[model samples]
Target chain A: MSKHVAYTDFIDCEEDVRIRAKDQARVVALREKKGWLFRLLLGLVLIGPGVLVMIADNDAGGVITYAQTGAAYGIGFFIPALLLSGLIAYVVQEMTVRLGAVTHRGHAEMIWGRYGAFWGWFSLVDLVLANILTLITEFIGVTLGLGVFGVPHVVSAAAAIAVDVVVLLVLRYYAWERVSLWIALGNLVFIPLALMSHPHWSTVVSAFSTWRVQGGFTPAFLFIVLANFGTTIAPWMLFFQQSAVVDKGLTVRDIRHGRVDTAIGTVAMVAVAIALVILTGTLVHGMRGASNLDIQQILSVLGQRLGPVGEDLFALGLVEAGMIAAIALTASTSWAMGEAFRWPKSINMPARRAWRFYLPGLLSAVIAAAVVLIPHAPLGFLNLTVQVVASIFMPAAILFLLLLLNDAAIMGEYTNRKWQNAAAFSIVGLLVALSGVYGLTVAMPHLL
Target chain B: MKKDTLSLVARTDRMAPVELTKAQVKGWVRVVFWGLRVYIVVMIVLVAIGFARGQI
Candidate 1:
């Protein structure tokens, strides 16, 4: 018995030493593999959704809003407004990445699981309706931009729809994302367009320093400002990123990469937004006042002010913005529908495998295109409807997001830290207050 | 026989119960969750009112 006990102890000691050696070797291997360059590359690969969401958030409507703001107000108040919005967009989207990565679930699923069927159905209806309305605005942008080149609205609308379809269908997830990113880069077209305008550099700098709200904040200006804010951070962004994170197979480990991606996107969005405002502010604002300067009018003004090349560039940027945002909104619609119905919902899924998931997006594109062809359709009214619907739905979307982010059962170790909640809540409160104030302004223009 | 014993041990390990009762919702989390619920309900009511009043 004594001899047997000694032999067992010796075997156990040998096994312990072998395990320790293996563990040390693993540590060394991990350290070697996760070198800074490798990590940087990995982060780049993981950055698509956040940046895409941010850029797509700066869609056709957002571009026009920034342009109008600059043209109407010059760079006085809007430059600071854009900076504040960029901060708010980052805070809101970062929470989505965390929720998605930690839970391995889409926002819809979490809402349904935690809040029961009533709220789940409510959210689904809001997302679908809002997505459809938003998609229509994207078509409006494309058609209007094309009009600058004398292309008929029908042709441009068809082409835009076809491009979005091909992108979502032919390209797998990674390839589709790359194509979208290329198109999104076209947003930077405004930067050169702004430069061509030869904006007074000193005045631009002074605007930032003054952060002046000239004309003393009339209700009209306040309404427009709030509208601009609503455009920047819409309800669709939350749904889109959470679903994108799940589709990309991100986990808690990828949260840092996701955050970095989001930051890059936020920076790009702000740059493009500021550039668009500068383009319009320098060329059109002081001259046109707040008069009815539709997108085409802005383009014509830009052409006269900065030459034909600038006009062409501005039109192309608008087209690209509309196209990229349409693709995102379509995908967001598909994703939300798939999640709500429990259908297969990944770009990774083959068409045959996920036909149901692709159908909603396809139908929405077709319907939006059809709507553009209707005569005397009050296209502006459609755009206004999208904004108003988005405004109404924004609070509910944000509230659900906060709930999920704070749910320990869902988020596990990745629940919102204190600062994140504070920032998110502040954004929610600000949005609610702005929407309310804007509603009042619209109702009683002279009240404020 | 020894192989059978090892397989039995693995199966038994796999069948161990997870301690569900140990999981507790912290007080702050409860507050945040309820707070979010209230916020959503309030917003929904406001939106409905706005729509009814044709102000939305």
Candidate 2:
């Protein structure tokens, strides 16, 4: 056993391979059947990781960031800017889908193997820290969401942790993915909230043609842009989606369907983000220090402006965002740790068998849940700092991803094409520029 | 069962480790890696400063 330990991998683990193969075998069955109905059903079955990662992309912090953006700048510039970030989200995430489908490995394992131990350890530590902090924001969203209904933070925290544990330990991969997808639909509650707010339809439409910032270029504006970018794509997303794709048993053949899954998810994420911005922008825009206000303050003003029904809807959406994101984030943490340490890491494994894999993820969630319960914890400050950290870390994460995608020895025929490389590199450049602006703004307060 | 589809998941060694040699990490790749390392460190320091001053 000790001699074989170094070769331990996710698929190599008995439980993981058995469950994944069982699930993928069914997808294969679905593909063999004729008719559009089977195709439709197959589409639903195949749309797991990509969609979950995308919807969960618009996590609790993301919801607040979009809401804050709307409340600050209203709907002119960010409307289109949000959509472009969605495109960026697609470009970055799609690479993971291909990488997973071709390589059948988690992002952590790929980095660990291909780049050597130092880079591997660096990426894993960065991701785990990022995931934990992001999970804290998710819990804050959960508490704030339920607190609107008179639920205490302690109760909300307990309930959130319990639900996450149940969802992870109780379900198999297929069941888990289906259940997660259904839960993710709750994120769309923002669409109804946006519609009910009665945002100026003409302004929303005109935003595309005009594409002009309400306040012109400023450091504050740039920081907000980076924040939105941070919300749209984060380090956890890359790890979560790729591991998910591999666990779901996607092969080179399923890459087309995987892209379909990802495309649908991108559309949903962008649309919901737009709804968030529109809902808050229409009602809360022009308030004093709109950008500076946290979610709780924004919610207070939203209640006053839109009445209890609107407030209640937004609250529910916040809870859903937090819940779905916590689920994805927890699993990603476990999978990354498993890949790094060679533990049996699959949602399909019984908790008893894969306790090592399950332990780290559960502990991270518990820590985050505890953090949110601290009185005077500066949740808003923490939220901003986490976003800044993630934004700063984006280029490094994408650089590793770009490197993995280009390695022809492993990817073989699946290697990234020139266009793909060019697009991905440009995204890295854009993130670096965004990060630089952030640094410049901080270093020289007078400079934009 | 379609063996090809099931084959994707049935195996384990498909993702065996592939460590790079010292000679492999070179040229623009080396420069880019060094540049990114410096970039990440600087950005983190700047963010720490911003957060400390409450300007970010």
Candidate 3:
């Protein structure tokens, strides 16, 4: 129902067009280069979507989850477990890189075309639903993070949506991506905050060898473990990154750079996540059974233990986490919907030209922000349900990804190698088992 | 043709989508699909029961 009146000359064509033009230009320019330096710069330029997807995966809910993990268990088992998650995220997402580069299709379009409409609709509905639910958590992070500074929820949530609209609408894809990359770099703030706590370096290093939960195995421990794993990789990541590759005009020649981009992002995500865990583990771990403290309580402890500067940094990091994830999630929803419907889907498209592509994404954000502003909305219950739905949808998403990767007709020479398939299937297997157990635990808390 | 024009032309002619009939997709693929269906169905049922029991 929204309309755009004023016209701007900032946008001319869809991002796909702009990116393809840029892709050719880069190739032509690279042909003359003979040094390692230019090659490195080119690799960095190709890094956008990969890094954005991974960092955004560590969203608002993810920050709180990591904080809780540290508070409850300290820097023991999860230090190693989190590193393993980064590798799993890379393995699963790397397939999307190849899939997009080869086929020039988003994840939803691939499922629709290759698997037929039944499964296609299933995946689409799942993705759109999960994207909306996840965005609500991101908004919750946005509102609550700002709430620390006494900013009202209405103002913060509305401002977050406004920032998204301007970013998506005003800048063309190339410029928009550059701006987002800057925001993603903000996620690193947790690193300095963790360092501020001056965690015991030897003890932190020893965690790899010590690898055991501080508390013995219990229903609560399993729930937290599953929660960490669930946040590590979500279905939107697959759709967002593939569509991003296609939009970025990454061809077979750039696949190496894509892998490097994904690897760097994996390192960055794990480091930040580890940093947050260490921060809480150091300051809040022993205080009145830190496992029981919520993020607000965790923040209070950070203030008391490390000073107001540390508390403010934690709050700001939460804000960054929510903002970056919302940016990526908005794009994922738009891109998946556009691909499924075969609409003109590109960030470079002008407002009028791609409104259908843009509307649903904006609407979803609006709804999420609105829900968060409602009084006594049972956000805790909503948060648990969000994970439950994502847990249910994740298996199907991975199954389709595996099938599409294995398909010779579409993927051609880019079809998954045997070792890659083994690694991917192993991750999928673990995810399925954990999700099933997690679901049952939710349904029957007594099951565990 | 100039490289720019040629690239533009290439971008215009998009690739056809990949589609497969049930007959073309078989063996383990079929079995995996069935297993996923059964898994999703059971999970949905369990979730529904849990919700109905007000166990969120």
Highest TM-score, which number?
3
lDDT by residue for model 2 (B1-56), tens: 43444453334223332343322677888898899889988898887788677776
Which is superior by TM-score, 2 or 3? 3
Candidates sorted on TM-score, descending: 3, 2, 1
Cα lDDT for residue A182, candidate 2: 93
Candidates, DockQ: 0.09, 0.32, 0.32
Error of 2 at A58 (Å): 0.8
Better of 1 and 2 by DockQ: 2
**Ten contiguous residues minimizing lDDT sum, candidate 2 chain A:** A1-10
- In candidate 1 chain A, what residue range of length 10 has the lowest lDDT sum? A14-23
Which of the numbered candidates is closest to the native, going by highest DockQ?
Answer: 3
List per-prediction Cα lDDT, in the order shown: 0.75, 0.86, 0.85
Q: Which stretches of candidate 1 lie over 4 Å from their true place?
A: A1-37, A288-291, B1-56
The DockQ for candidate 2, computed on C-alphas, is 0.32
**Over the stretch A370-418, how does candidate 1's per-residue lDDT look in tens digits?**
8888988877767766776777678778877887777676567888899
CAPRI tier of model 3: acceptable
lDDT at A426 for candidate 1?
Answer: 92
TM-score of each: 0.85, 0.92, 0.93
- Please state the error at residue A229 of candidate 1 in Å: 0.7
